[model samples]
Target chain A: MHPVAVVNANGASPIVFVCEHASNNIPNMYHELGLNAADKISHAAYDPGALGVLRCLVNEFDAVGVYGTVSRLIYDCNRPPEAASAMPAKSEKIIVPANANITPAERDARTNAVYVPFTNTLADIIAQKGGQGIVITIHSFTPTYFDEPRHVEIGVIHDDDPTLASACVTELQGDGSFVCEINEPYSREDGVAHTLNLHGTKNGLQNAMIEVRNDLIATPDDEMKMGIYLAQQLRKTFKSLGIDLNEVSA
Target chain B: MHPVAVVNANGASPIVFVCEHASNNIPNMYHELGLNAADKISHAAYDPGALGVLRCLVNEFDAVGVYGTVSRLIYDCNRPPEAASAMPAKSEKIIVPANANITPAERDARTNAVYVPFTNTLADIIAQKGGQGIVITIHSFTPTYFDEPRHVEIGVIHDDDPTLASACVTELQGDGSFVCEINEPYSREDGVAHTLNLHGTKNGLQNAMIEVRNDLIATPDDEMKMGIYLAQQLRKTFKSLGIDLNEVSA
Candidate 1:
C-alpha cells in the first residue's frame, strides 16, 4: 500500500489537515509485529479514532488531508526516523519483538520505504498551497495512559510560533464543550510538535495540532460531532483572523 | 525576482546544500528595510563568507545548492515565520527600524514574498532526491558577540539526527586547520537548527549545518581556501561514511 493517503489532493481549500497516527493496520509480512490481539488495538499502536474525525474534518472544511496508511508499530510517522522511538522496542508497557535487534540498514530501509514517502507527499501538498497554507494536524490520546487520567480535551500544540495556536485556543475556549490548553498533554519537547515544525512553522504557515481525548471520540458518531464542532470553531477563528481561505496562493 | 537561487539543482549528488544567510540585499521597494549602509553589511544582516564556502561545496561534490536571495534582516529563511526572530527588530544591540512595530499583514507579506518561495523550492529539490537526500546548510558567525569571544573555528550543528554531524566532526578532528565542535556556535534552541530540523531530520535525511568564524573568511582568497578545505573535508567524510552521492534516489 502507499505510505500515505491524501484526501482531496486537488481540493480548493487552502488549509491542509494531517492525521499522523491515522491507521493501525500492520502489514501481513511483519506478522502483527509480535503483538497480542488486545495490545494490537491499544493506543500504543495508533490513535484509536483519529482517522474518522479527520475525515469528517476534511468534509466539513473542504480541505486537503494527509493520512498515514500503516500502524505506528511498523514506523511512527510523526517521529524523526533516526530516533529510536521511531521504531520503538517497547511502547507503554508492551514489548515489540519485531523492533528488537534491528540493524541500521533495516531501520534505514523502513525510513526510505515509509517515512520518506509520507514526508514527500505532505511536502508536496504544502507546496501546492503556497506560503499561505494553514496546517491543522489531528491526533488523540487515551483518557487513561498507564493509569493516570488526562482531563484536557483539546490541546493546541505549537513550537516557536504561538500566534496560530493562541488563536485556536481562544476560539476553542469559548465553545465550553471541553477544556482547552496551550501545549497541554504534549509540547514540542515531547517530540509531538515535529510535524508542525516541519510543515507548518518551517514554511510560516498558520499551523496548529489539536489533540482530542480518545474517550471523547469513542464512537463514530461522537467523532463526527467533534469534527463538525472543531471545523465550525476553526471557521469562526479564521473569519475573526480575517484569513480568506481562497487567497492562499501567493 | 526569485526568492531562491538553485545552483546545480539537478546535480547527481545525494547532498543538497543550503546557505540561508547568503545575501544581504534588501529589495529596493522596502527602501533597504530602513537600515543604514553599515548595518546592511553587519552580521545582523547576513552571514559573511557562507555563500563562497557553499559554492565550493557545490562545485567539489557536484551537489545541489539552494541559496536565499534576500537578507535575514528582512525575513530569516531559517526561522519559523511566526517567530519574532524571523523578522528581528534588534540583533546584537542594533535596532532594525523596519522590523519594529510592523503590522501582522506586513510581516505576512514579507514571508509570502521571500520565505515561501525559498521553502517551496527546497522542498521540491528534496522531493526530487526521494529518500536518499542529505542536507548540508552553510552559515557564518561573528568572532565576538555581546562582549564575548569565541575560540572555536567550526561548528557542526544537528537537530535530532546526529549521524551526519558526528561523521563530519570525526573527519575534521586533527585537521590542523580549524577547531570544530558538534552543536556549537548555535544549536536547536538558538533557532540555528531550524533548517536542519525542518528539512533534514523531519524528512529523515542525513544532515548538518557548518558554521565558520567570519574572520576566517575575511578575504576573497581566504574564502576560496576555506571553501576548498571544507569541500575536501566533506568529501572525505562522505567517502568514510560509504555514501554514494549519485545513488540518492532510493
Candidate 2:
C-alpha cells in the first residue's frame, strides 16, 4: 500500500496543505502494531477528522493536499527518523508491542517506507509553487487528553516563524467566534511543529498548522465549516502580508 | 565562565554572526572531558579559527557576533540536545571516553551549561533585529576528515532555504578567486544546518553557513583575508537580492 495519498496534485493555487495523521490503517505486516480493536480507531491511531478538513481547504482554494495514509503508530511522518517518538513504544496509555525494542533494521525499514515518501511528495508539490507557496498543515486534537480538558477550538501553531500564525490568530480574534489561540494544544516544544518547521519555516514560506478540536470536526459538515472559516482567515492573512494568490510567476 | 561571547553586541548592522564551534576549552568541571593535551587542541575538540573569522566578519560589517566559548566536545552548540552528536561519544575516529554512556543528568547538565546559554543569547539578539536580521554562521572545517582528502576550500551551506546560499555562490563564482561549493563537505543531511535551520530560516531571515577550510584560515592574517573576501561576496549577494544594508528599518 502507498504510504501517502496526494489530492489536487495539479491545483493552480499557491497554497499547499499537509495532513500527516490522516489515516489509521496499520498494514498486515505489523498486525495492527498489536493494538486492540478499540485502541485501533482511537485518536492515538490518527487525528480524527484532519484529512476531511484538509480536503475541504484543498477544494476551497484549489490547493494541493498531501496526506499520510498509514497509522502514526507505525511510523509518525511528522517526526524525524532520529526521534524515538517516531516509532513509539507507547503513546499516552497504549503500549505498542510491535514498536517496543524494535531493531535498527526494522526502524529503518518503517522510516523508509512511511516518512521518506510522504516527505518527498509534499516537498515536490511545494517546490513547484516556488516562492509563492504558503504551507498550511491540518490536524485535529482530542477535546480531552489524559482526562484533562482543552479549551482551544482552533490552534494556529507556528515554530520560529510566526507570520502566518500571528495573522490567523488576529483574524480569528477579530471574528470573535472561535476559541482561537497561538501555539495552543501543542507547540514546537511538544515536538508537534516538526512538520511545520521542516516543510514551512525552513523553506522561507509563510506557514501555519491549524489544529481544530476533534470534537469540533467530528462530522463531514463540521469539517467543511471549519475549513471554510480557516480559508477566510488565511485569505486575510495573505492580504496583510502583501501576497496575491492569483499572481503568476514570470 | 560565560558559555558564549558576544562581540559588537550593540552593533546597528542588520546581519548577525554565529560561531558555535569556536573554542576548545573543556572547562575544569569534567576534567577536560577526558582528553589529552594534543587531542584537546585538535579539530575534534572544536572548529579551529572559526571565532577569528567570525570576529573579522563582525568588524568588517559592524555586525553583532555571538560565539560559544566552550569546546564543542563538551557540548556542540550547533546541534540540538536530542542529537547524539551534541555530546558525542566519538568524533571522527577519536573516542571520547567521558561522553560514552553518560547519565541523562550529566547530559542535561552539559546542555544547560553550554548549549542552552549559547542558544538563548543568539535567539535574543536575533529577536531584537525585528525581522531585518540576516544570520550568517561561520566555521572552519578540517582540510581532511578521517583518512579522506577534501578539495573544497569554502562551503556556502544552507538547509531548506537556499536563497542566500545560491546568491553567495553565484557571486563567488563571478569573482573567480576561491574554491567555493554549495553544501559540499557537509550538508543538511550531515546535521550541519541545525543552527541555521533553528535561528535563521525559521525566523524568515535570509541565512547561510559559511564553511572555510581550516588550512585557509589557520592564522590571524588568513582569517581576516577570508572574512573580508566573504564580506564582499555577501554584499554583492544582498545587492542582487535588492537588500540595502545601509537602510534603517522603520
Candidate 3:
C-alpha cells in the first residue's frame, strides 16, 4: 500500500495542500480497535469524512497534496516524534486496544514500518516542489469535545506562519456563513507541530492548518461543496497576496 | 496480541524501566519491508537485540518495564509529538513499500491505533507509580552509522536529570575496562531531548536514556551480562540518592 499520495502539480505556484488527519482506517489485522461493528463506525475509529473533502480540494487546485494512509492511533502524523501523543495517544479519552501496551521492539517496528516511511514521502514531495510554496494542511475536528460545545465554525492554526493564517482568517471572516478564528479552538502552544513544522515552517514554506467541523463535511456532497468553497477562498487570498496559484504547479 | 507488554516484579521496586527501541518486528503481512529474507534479518527491520537486553534487565532487577510494540519508524516513541521524525516517515534513503504512499485517513488510523495508546500506557504507568520514582529508558544504537565508525562505548543521555546522568557518568568513568564518555557518543542536542523533555523533566521524574552499542549486546550472553552490569550500577546510584527502588511494584 502506498503510504503517501501526491499530486505534484510541479508548477510555479506557491501553495501545497496537505491533509494530516485524513484517514481512519486500521489495518485489517488490527480490526476495529478491538471494538464491535457499531464502535468501528463511531467517530473514534475514523475521521468521519475527511478523505472525500481532501480529494475534492486536490482535484480543484493544481497543487501538491500529501497525506497518510494508516490511522492516527497507529502514529499521529501531525504530532512531533517525541510527544507522547505522537505515538499511542490517549486523546478523546478513548483506549485503543491495539496500542494499549507495547514492547519497545514492537514500538520500533511500527515506527520503522509505518511512521517513518509516511513522513519521508512528505519530505520528498516538499523537496521536489522546491521554494516559495504555501503549505495548507486540511483537517476536521469534532463539533463538541468532551461533551463541551465548541462554537467556532472554523479554526485556522499556525505555529509562526501568521502571514498566511491572517490572510486566510480575513478571507474566511468575509464569509458570513462561518466564524473565522485565528488559532482559535486550538493553539500551537499545546505542542502539536508535526507536519506543519516539518514540511512548512522548517523549510520556510508559508503554511496553515484549516480545521472544519466534521459534521459540515460528513457526506460526499458536503465534502465537495466545502472543498470548492475552501479552494475558492484560499485561491482568492493567494491572488490578493500577489501569489500565483498556477506558479505552485511548476 | 497485546500491543504493549508491562512486566513488573510485583515484589518491591520503584524503578520504571522504559525500552524505547526494544522490538523491530513487522507484521507478517508487511513481509520484511518488501525485501528478501536476507534483508529482513538485517538491522533495517529490527533493533538488533534490544529486546533481549531489556528482558535480561527486567528479569535481573525485578523492575517495572513499559515497552512499545510498534516500530520506531512508524512513530518513534522516544520523540516528542512535534519532532519531524515522529510519524508516517516516508524517506529513510530506502523505500518502505508497505508505507510508500498512504492517505490521510490511514495516517489518523495509525495514530489512533498505535501512537496514542502506547504513550497513554506510559502516562498511566507513571501515574499509577505516583510522582516519586526513577524512569530509566533503555535503547540501543547502531555501532556503525552511515558507514562511520562510532567510538563511544555507551551514551548516558539526559536533558534536566543531570544529577542522575552525572552519577552514571561518574560510575562509567571510574570503570577502566570500558572507555565511558559522559555525552560523547550522543547528546540531547541531537534530538534526545524529545524523550527526556516530556516523560522526565516535564513530569519532574528523574530519568535518562541509556544507549548501549548494539554490537556489544548482539548476543544473548552479552545482553544478559550488560543488563546485570547496568542494573547493579543503577541500584547503587538510587541507594546513594536516597531513592526507594522498592516502591515501583503495583
Candidate 4:
C-alpha cells in the first residue's frame, strides 16, 4: 500500500477531513519500530478508532481524506518534520528504541517516505478546492491516561485561527448530545495542532481538529454514527461561518 | 533576489555546479539569528568563499548554478530537512543561540523559506537540461579546526556512485599542480551526501562535491583562479569520463 491513502479522490467537498494517526501497523521496513506486539496496538502507536470514524466521515460527506498508512511511531504525519516528537524517543513511558539514535539522513529518509507525501497530498487537495478548502481533522484519545481519568468526551482542537473550531464547538454544544470542549486534553502549544497551523492558518483556510474519546467510539456502528453526526454539524458549522462547501460530484 | 539564484538559468554545460552554504547573511526575517557581528562573518555562519568560486564556475563554463542565499546557521541547504544540523544548534565550539529553542513550525518556516527554494530550483534546472545534467557542488572549509591543521588543498566529495568525483580526482592529480583527495575532511557518512544522493545518484546523474580550503580562496583573484582551474580540469575530466559537454547558446 502507498504511504498515503486519498479517499474520495475526486470528492470536491470543501470540508476536507484528515486523519493522521489512523494506522497502528508500522510499515514492514521499520520492523514494527522495535515495539512489542502490545505496544504496536496501544494508543501510543495510533488513535485506534480515528480511521473508522474518518472513513465514515469521508463516505457520508463524500469528503476527501489523507491518511498515513504507516504507524505514527515511525513518523507522525500530524507533526511538522522539525518537531522533536515527529519521530519520538518516547511516548508516555514507553521508549521507542529505534527512534533514539537515527542519523539525520535516516530521519530525512523517513520524512520523505512518509511525512512529505501526506502533507503534499493534503496541500494538493486543499489547492484543488480553491478558496473553499476547509480542513477538519479527526482523532481519538483514550479515556484514561497514565492511570488518570479524563472528563472531556469530545474536543474541538484549534490553533490561532479558532473560528472554524469555535463554531464547531458551539454547534456540538447546541446539539446537547455530547460533552464538547475547546482544546481539551490537547492544545496547539502542546504540539497537537501542526496540521491546523500549517494547512489551516498558514494557508488561510478555516480548519479545526476533533478528538473523540476512544471508548465512546469502540465499535464500527458507534464510529459511523459519530461520523454521521459530525458531518451534519460540519455542514451547519460551515454555513454558520459563511463558508460554502461545494460537494464533489462522485 | 529570489530565494535561489540560478546563474545561467538555461545553461546546458554537462557540469552543473551548486553551492549550498554559499552565503552568510540570514534572510531579513531571521535578524542575523542573534549572532554577534564576528560570528556572523566567521566560518560558523557559512562557506565564505564558496559563492565566489561558484559564480566564476558558472560564468566560465556558461553552466547552470544553484545557490542557497541564506546563512547555514539558519538552514543548511545541503542537509536533508530531517537532519539535526539542518538547523544546527552549534557549529564547532560556538553555539547558535537562536537555533537552540526553535519550534518545529518555526524550523519548517526556515526550511520553507530557505531550503526548499534552492532544491526546487536545482531540480527545475536539471529537468530543463533534458537528460544531460551532471551535478558538481562547490564548498570551502577552514584550513584548521579545533587546533588541528588540515593538509588537503582540495576535497572531492562523492556519494555511493563515485564515478564523477573519482575521475575529477584522477585528473586533478595528473595535473601535478594541486593536492586533491577523495572524501577528505568529509564523506557521505558525515551527512554531507544528501544532495548528491538525491540530485545525483537518485536521478542517475554523475555528481561530485568539491571542498576547497578557505584560506586559498580569500580574495577575488584567488576564487577566480581556482574556478578557472577547476573549469578547465572539469572539461578534461568530463571528456575522460566519456561525458560530453553540451554548451548552451548564449
The sequence of per-residue lDDT tens digits that candidate 4 reaches over residues A1-250 is 4678777678757768899987665756787778986676678888866876897798777778887777788899999888889999898877888999989998899899998988998888888877567788999998988889888899998888889889999999998788999998899889999988888888887888999998876543356567888888887897797765654322
iRMS (Å) per candidate: 25.5, 26.7, 20.9, 26.9
Highest-scoring model, lDDT: 2
| Ten-residue stretch with the least lDDT total in model 3 chain A | A5-14
Q: Model 3: per-residue lDDT, tens digit, A3-39?
A: 5555544534456677765555456666655655544
Q: What's the ranking of the predictions by TM-score, best on top?
A: 2, 1, 4, 3
Q: What tens digits encode model 3's per-residue C-alpha lDDT throughout B7-66?
A: 653524556778755545444444545655543344544455566567667776666688
DockQ of each: 0.01, 0.01, 0.01, 0.01
Off by over 4 Å in 1: B1-250
- Mark the 10 consecutive residues where model 4 chain A has the least summed lDDT: A241-250
Cα deviation of A40 in candidate 3 (Å)? 3.0
Instruction: In angstroms, give how far residue B129 of model 4 lies from its true place.
Output: 1.2
The sequence of per-residue lDDT tens digits that candidate 4 reaches over residues B1-250 is: 3567676676657667898887665656777688887677678887866876897798788788888767789888889898989999889877888899999999888888888888888887787766667889898988898979999999998999989899999999899677889998899989998888888888888889999998777543356568888888888898897766754322
Q: Per-prediction fnat values?
A: 0.00, 0.00, 0.00, 0.00
Q: When superposed on Cα atoms, how far off is each prediction in RMSD?
A: 23.5, 25.2, 22.7, 22.6
Model 4 chain B is weakest, by summed lDDT over 10 consecutive residues, at B241-250
| TM-score per candidate | 0.50, 0.50, 0.48, 0.49
